[model samples]
Target chain A: MGEVKNKQVILKDYITELFKESDMDIVEGAITLELPEGPNEVLLKNLYLSCDPYMRNRMNKILKIEGPATLLVGYVWGFTKWEEYSFVPSSRILFKIEHTDVPLSYYTGILGMPGITAYSGFFEVGLPKKGDKVYVSAASGAVGQLVGQFAKLSGCYVVGSAGSKDKFRFSVFVNTSKSFANNLILHASPPLHLNAYLSTTILQIRYFPEGIDIYFENVGGKTLNAVLLNMRINGRIVVCGMISQYQSAQPEGVTNLKKLITKRIRMQGFVVRDYYPMYPKYLEYVLTKIKEGDIVYVEDIVEGLENGPAALVGLFNGRNVGKQVLLVSRE
Target chain B: MGEVKNKQVILKDYITELFKESDMDIVEGAITLELPEGPNEVLLKNLYLSCDPYMRNRMNKILKIEGPATLLVGYVWGFTKWEEYSFVPSSRILFKIEHTDVPLSYYTGILGMPGITAYSGFFEVGLPKKGDKVYVSAASGAVGQLVGQFAKLSGCYVVGSAGSKDKFRFSVFVNTSKSFANNLILHASPPLHLNAYLSTTILQIRYFPEGIDIYFENVGGKTLNAVLLNMRINGRIVVCGMISQYQSAQPEGVTNLKKLITKRIRMQGFVVRDYYPMYPKYLEYVLTKIKEGDIVYVEDIVEGLENGPAALVGLFNGRNVGKQVLLVSRE
Candidate 1:
């Protein structure tokens, strides 16, 4: 391995306001493609990089940053840019690609961290039983789509809410512009009118008439508040992400938390890193689902490292149609 | 058994605004002190009545009312007034008075619903470990006091916040007036300056240097938001009650819910009815603690049924120094 010209997306400055593409600087840098002499060091050509919502949280200075530059390829190493040909610690790579028949890019989205997130969040946290009424927010995205499919596989009546109608098979397509108005109505009204607005709650009740047993929380904010209203007794709210509130100057205040007590709801948040040990089992299950055509994944691939900054920022704006991925190289 | 003059306190109307003493009507009524001809009917002289925060939720017609008039006393029977003698179902009496060595009023506080709430919320939901940092809000209240004691017994470092200086041995005495100002400062600042205000977060950090492992959430609103800022990784927030917001026309919005995802926090709410099966064990455990003098319970007893309405209303006003109970008649 030799030093190579690496086209990189550098975080020139921490984003103080809502994320803009200009916040990232695309710079031409050189990297020695050889692993440093250490017991736990791995060298690999970056094939596919994932654009996740949680990556936005890292842009803020409050959260702790840990691990090598290329470790998770996205979350860790605050200064690590969208670069080509980087070296990372061997331990970071939880598993090596064994099944080459599938697209290697699948490792970044459907078969990687997001896959484990969907698996653990849905099965362990959500605790969906047969005939359980399940509701998932941001249902077209990386994790939500899998969560909905997983619920369907468990004989649950799964309803998904997405930003647009064309993204995926969403039960409710929430128009982002109208959603703010819906949120205002849901928050202002004390008696939670089911017919007042086409809010997440009304749509949820319309789809799952019996009320939501398990809520796979991805978008958070108004969706979370709406779900809180429609949750059944002893309902489970698996808090995966709050993507909607990440960019706001002041995060929205959740007023309907009292419903948690009345409904005996368990709202829990978990990270994929904690559930990494079960990756092998999850991989097998997800691979089988893909092979059987029971699961389908959509990826919005943006070519070249220079376009990575735009693709990453596009996530906050809900610009991408599916799991936004930056194709660094074909490998 | 004959008909007797019963001085009753009837809810004049459903209170949509903050609860006031005027909302209740003291009426002269009569009740036959005889058991009805039914297998599951029990006619007993109402001895001690409990004034709990949950009763406020019932005042709003949104929450479901289950069982006959006297079960949990105030929460059920929308029309059940603050009365002297009442007819109730036999099954409603969850426990028979096994030990008379303690005050019968203990059945309303330490030996009753609040006792179970503390035990289960702390042990089952909070899941505190040895050396864990525990913080309880409304620390001198029925449930909060016990939760602190229980945390201490489990070899955990416990800190409690109370509204007044005289209420029990609170680790931090949060002056209610100053607390409101502190809450304003805390909410206004996004960066969270440690020295800006002696807010719940600062007081919490002063008590638990390592951050909070378990937060026994008896008082929500501002305290909850402050606790959210200082929660340790994988922290447990047992959602017992939000007494601060129960009376308000609009509940406060919790702005720091993003902390849930960052810290992988678990916030769960449970009612005592769900954990009734654990009553025997909790009873034995609490009784032993009382006998050993490891736990000390204080009750603010208002004598006579006429004072019941005033005492119940006093709970909202923070007039009661301890567990507010009404003495209906001597055993």
Candidate 2:
């Protein structure tokens, strides 16, 4: 195959603060569409790209995505680059998309890493019981959305916050750079500063004066502190990500940790990598839930590979409404 | 029945800061040495009074103890008044001293609350594995002492601190008040302020450069923050008490909680009441260990009930070492 014009999004530098569109550079690159000779290699015409919080946190320093003509791609090396065409090692790919009935873009969200993350973090780690008062931060996002739905499915009462999920109160929209943006979902006045997020969250948690039983933590720092104060006896906190603290030199101090002892609470952190073994079981259950209308997933997809940079940075602010995905190609 | 003059340690008022000897007043009050009419009432002479960190913390506000008199007592009413002789509802007493071969005072610690606390907190909540690196704060105290021995019993590497144990580095003798005192066990310069406790702990953790797999958390606030920094991936922290913050009007903030997510740590808080069901099993195991000399306990015993006030206040400033037991009368 001849070299095809492949547009790319390259991370210009390591982000120190809130992610900016200028931090990334869009460039046109070319790649041969032929699969290079390798034992477990396949040429993946990048269809949808995922933008997740852990992509930056787990990587330690920066989020890197190779533009077109990516010679190497593996799950261990992170998702395929934000480009049109790429060579992917089959061994590194976490799973194959067997069910085509759902939107192919779903692979980047409810059917992918974010999906399993919510599955294991909530059910396995959180250990929700029926009638449990569950709280989810970053609720409009990929994993948070599923956690809320899962809580409800487990016969628990769930309250979701972050972005414009009308059912949830307080827009605690946390971005990667730790810079919060315009309020979109808060019932009362939204907190402008990052530090004030905890006080406001504590105030808003008054809605559940009785207390939260299971807290699906996505945005850490202040929100986590607030959750600590509102946690009921024997409550469980499933720490999945600290998106609010990703860009921070020093993450905020959580003061109410003594409550863990006072209330007999359990806070646990888990990585999806450990839970991948149960993926097949999770898939059957989740797919069935999706078909039965028991669960819902919202995707905020930006079309065209060139818009990938904008969509990714949008995650830092409340600009993106749901699971942030960039469409690289229709294939 | 003739009324007998009974000595009692009375809590004068709610403590504001560090527990002062003046906070408790020793008094001689009269009590009828007769069994009460209640079905489970027992006319008993108080032998030993236990001074525990939780006695001040779990009660929410001030640590209150009634002076000896012809009055009522229940398990929910906290420990029997720090007294010489009293009428105790049999229901209020946690257990009967079954094995007399051991010190009868063992009921106040190793064979009682502190014993089961270390057992359940270490084995049940911590979920420690063999060869795990375990760190215990307030290591010379009742619960921490046992937690360290339990870690060793579990075939894990144990490092303990607080109150000149020679074996463990750094004297982190946390009292009810946040005030730190003259360094006791510290090989290096002891941190002066309460805030520096975290940074110093983080520094000392370099001894176990590899990382801590289990942190038996006895002191909360700063030390807890320090443990988070040195925690290995998949570490477990058993939150037993927050002795450091027991007297503070506002507890110190614990930063580094995000490490829970990065390292996939599990921190759980448990009450001894929950583990009482397994007391028989724990008693057998601990008694056998004690007889085998596999475990050692230190007790800073005050000879008379009059000295109880001094011994109790001594706990806040590293004055009392080991279990901090007050000997009212010996059988």
Candidate 3:
């Protein structure tokens, strides 16, 4: 019995609870070594934790709001150390992470839900037209990188926003540099309208001065409110994330919704699960782009499971650049 | 000069502007006898004036707003008083007064611009699918009467609001008295939701009980604000007029446009000119229905040129029970 137990693999997972305090508690849960019974289920030793805007929805008890509520509450509650979580991700029914050629930690960032989100939203709802102006917020983060690249591939004028000058410069350099390196031709066309000379920060300031036809919304707050005023007539806003407002007790104020009437804007929210059917097509297309050097991928990888909590928490503070992923173990 | 004028019949007709405050000044522009130029432009005597909601656009100082603002303002200004308004009498250009054996005053009310406004807006924009709930403000007026009748003809369960109970009862009675009314034929199903069994009223409170799917908006104010909140998902609002706000110094507060986002409602402001091409088919169909007793046609015929101002003003006040037309020089 002692020998069998010695051979057994023990896993450490982070958790929080129904405590009144807003801080997350890293509580321990029962570790299991036996294989999950479900045929499709993959026993993934979670290398990285994804902190996303949609997860905020799951944090709150589901109110019958007329918008898309969070689907992540189950996972949040399951990992939370509480006698009554009110929700939990069922062990056998969890979405399993499949094999990826890139760093497994990418599952928490680019190769995970956020990447799929950016891909699906930009391709589907945005319906990017060649030469159309594209705007993205939190451009240095997980989803924004892939979205900017996708926009470039689709022959769109992509501009993105980030927190610091370093991050902003990095995004711009990466965007302008990678496409050239990838054999994806990046040519400067006649600057379209008033937005031609503007930087991502100024573009955010002007909310796409000439007017953004397509917006990949991530960081929501005053930025979103600003974007609302500048959206062109018949604009499309893909509600990818509202990261800025995720931790706040109150949602951000949106004053410019009246523009929706005159502009005929379509703001749609969606989850990656809805895009699973297009996975093969997406994988084939994105993988080809990556292999051909048309896609420049970056990651801020944290080594060891001990550093996962700090790395994950640092995301809210904009402490990490590119995709923040934790290297749980070296196989 | 008298001898020269005597050779031709001097037709000094006094044309009145339907809307007094309109930018179109009803000047009695003098003209000597003129030869008929074409079949389309009929040089009819300035007999009666058509007071309509569409005329409001003509009265506005043209602003550079999106859409054909110039064209709309120009069209409205073209209807100035005492001017020989030469227009195509074809159903494509004007909603011709069918069964011309009726009073020329009918051209302004039951058979004129307002008639087509009611017809096109209610049928085309409203798209009243059978069993869908409908709400029509100014239900006793020119446009609202036809809207209610058309909804009923399309096998829709209809409820309309008027200033008085008499007009309300009359609108419903018109539907009941019709020999081939859809409600009388195969009974249309009730609304699919639970909150559709309440009585509609001129007061906005009536909306809280049963949400409206199609709002044929002729009156805008608290009524519109109420409708905004009560609109179901994908609801359609046809903005035919803002009678309540037109005469007011300030447009009424619309605090509930946020509902439009969640509901995905489509509210459009359009003129009858959009549907003018269909006038021939519309008139033939509408007249046939009236003749076949499938639809009821109602109007309030105001007597004499002196009463034109009173009748026009009555439109805003909701004093007129049905279509308001001034009978000037009788045909």
Candidate 4:
């Protein structure tokens, strides 16, 4: 078991420039299959790797580096590269896969961290009710897709904004760029000159005519500003990820925060780690939904560990159409 | 009743420039003190007028004009002038004052709108637990003063920022400008050049060594930016008011919103109206505290209705040391 060669992705240097695929170096390494001599540690084979936007923050020096490279770690840790056959501590592995009928890659996404994120962020933080008007950004991503489905299941009118219309088959697929252009044209008339600040507001009003009750914030910046204006009184904004501003030199200032007070909006940010106790419940519910065909997921799988860097970097540029997954091993 | 002279304060025109005493006009007019023929309407003499920072927004064309001139109206209404008498519709009044032993002006501050604002913003929105580190901005003002006292009662370590040190005896009164200067001097060394963004972070760290569990935000802009960086994981910021930005041509953009996700903070904005149902519970609790000498209030009273404009405008400049109140005929 100790003789097996391990392919590992290593962060060669902390990113100084906008993150690129070259920053991460894939190197061939070796690790023992046997568990280390500790009461708490366990050895397991790496199956599927997740390509998430949060990993970009880790690549830069912004996020702290710690813990094993697996789901449900005690604390948020740095990302592991396109790697295979790595031995992680026991606690790092949230729960062992017992259900084999579902794809093993689902654990890395819809059945794992992203799954719980969508659940807790939408239900707990978002506080969605029946007939709620929900708007989700990055609609095709792992978490956003699940959030929209959950909202729809709750009898909500869900609209999603994606980088491109092809990203997801949403009830209303708003191409963010085209929407902005339309907003400019609509507000070009006299007595209503729209600036970048007001333009977002005008565009969002056009998208969600009745106003949004729950905003599942996946991409922050202009999208967040736009949603702020269109939010109904007592609206809830669940901040999951700010993928758009993750690699920017300076984060864009949210100018429409005044609406928060006027509309009495609640904007809360959450990490999935905080709600790990509900993972079992979430898994049961999501698995049932998947089985019932009530919840559908879209995965953009990149074969081989070598393509991991490009797949991960593609998240920032909105290159990947869906849940970006790096396939590490068949086992 | 129609023969009585009504000293009226009327908004002569919408303000385009920075607010001044001249924005409001005082005129002697007449109104029937008798209620009009309506089942929902009641007529009462105007006892004390509350001078609040939110009124600054109404003074400009920003806030919509609606409803009558009194505290806790059905909806947030437009500003009224520095006049002695006026007839307002019955439903516009939230609740009739039942207790009279305390100053009638207390209804305008500690017992009325400001009192509930503090109660809901601190307990409901801020969600401070025992022994939590709490920070309150605009410490000496109506809402801020009560928030600090409430936090202390809850066994939380409380700190407050005020325009002047003499304004309310808080546990810690951070003179904002002085704190900023100190932050600048402390970060004069290499690798720590403080910009507008980083400077606020440094200042907050100095004030809150253990990080803040809850921030009772009243004065936003730079103060909000500062509190964001110093927020502990899962911290709550109750956005009660942004007095600093109410009169600005363009509200300052908050740049460190990414910290919301990184720190898992919940920044919620609320109006006191949402929690009006809890007014009874809050009033009883506050009245008990007042009787027990557990709470003390300070009111900066401006005598006469003519001085109302100056008192109202004084809030923007931080001129009023405490709860700014206009003595309109203390019936």
Best model per DockQ: 1
Kindly list the per-residue Cα lDDT of model 3 for residues B161-275, writing each as its tens digit. Answer: 5552222222222235443123222112333211122223422353335567888877665566667767777677877776655654344445444444446566655566666
After the best TM-score superposition of candidate 1, give how far the Cα of residue B273 lies from its true spot, in angstroms: 0.7
Q: Name the lDDT of candidate 3.
A: 0.53
lDDT of 1 by residue, A1-331 (tens): 6878887677766666688788888788887866579788655556677788888877877665321122233322211335675665556444656776777777777887788899999998878899888877777788887887788777877766666222322235322231211221112322432222335535545566678899888876766877787889999999999887888778778888988887889999998889988988998898988888777787788888778778888887667766888887765
Regions more than 4 Å wrong, model 2? A58-78, A163-206, B38-40, B58-78, B163-188, B191-206
| CAPRI grade of model 3 | incorrect
Ranking by DockQ: 1, 4, 2, 3
lDDT (Cα, 0-100) at A169 in candidate 2: 35
Clashes of 4: 1
- Regions of candidate 1 where Cα sits further than 4 Å from its true position: A1-3, A32-41, A62-81, A164-201, B34-40, B62-81, B164-201
Write model 1 residue lDDT over B246-302, tens digit each, in one string.
877777788889888878999999988888799889988989878987777878888
Q: Among all windows of ten consecutive residues in candidate 2 chain A, which has the lowest summed lDDT?
A: A174-183
Error of 2 at B27 (Å): 2.7
Question: Candidate 4's residue-wise lDDT over B97-188, tens digit each?
Answer: 66767787787788888998999999988878898988887877888888878887788777776652223222244323312112111112
- Residue B220: error of model 1 in Å? 1.3
Model 1 / residue A213 / CA error / Å: 1.0
Q: Candidate 2, B293: how far from true, in Å?
A: 1.6
Taking all chains together, each candidate's TM-score versus the true structure is: 0.86, 0.86, 0.59, 0.85
